[model samples]
Target: MAEVPIVVHPAIEQGGRAVVVRNEVAGLAHCDREVVEFLRRVGLPLSDDILDDPVWVEWRGGRAHDYEAA
Candidate 1:
């Protein structure tokens, strides 16, 4: 007799949501409009908890990092 294999997927329901997942590709922001549009799409103004994430820390510029710490 032959056995069949089963495949499992984690959190399949959460797909297609606006979340900052690591290692996913990010496009270059060509202009200020693109930046604002991305933020708007992600449902900003984000809460402090969201802002405190390490991914955000890594992506922010030096000046913005200073403001984040303050």
Candidate 2:
């Protein structure tokens, strides 16, 4: 079996690292919007305004990947 590629976006801070890591397997199995909605349904707070920002997305992705803080 081939290893699924992990999609991640790095944070915008100086010296920041990957803040979000999306598992390709899961992402392929489920839609990204659905996943986000699921998180919201599960009481995971998310702000639409924040989502609208590319930097926040990067920061979120990086944080998920346990990247070092900038």
* Residue-pair clashes per candidate: 0, 6
Off by over 4 Å in 2: 1-29, 48-70
The best candidate by TM-score is 1
Model 2 lDDT per residue over 1-70, tens place: 4432233344444433331223422221122354355445445456655444454343244344343434
TM-scores for candidates 1 onward, in order:
0.29, 0.26
Score candidate 1 by lDDT.
0.32
lDDT tens digits, residues 13-62, model 1? Answer: 32221223233322334333433345556555544453344434233333
Give the Å shift of residue 45 in candidate 2. 0.7
For candidate 2, what's the RMSD?
A: 11.8
Clashes of 2: 6
Candidate 2 global CA lDDT score: 0.39
Worst 10 residues of 2 by lDDT: 21-30
Clashing pairs in 2: 18-62, 19-61, 19-62, 19-63, 20-61, 20-62
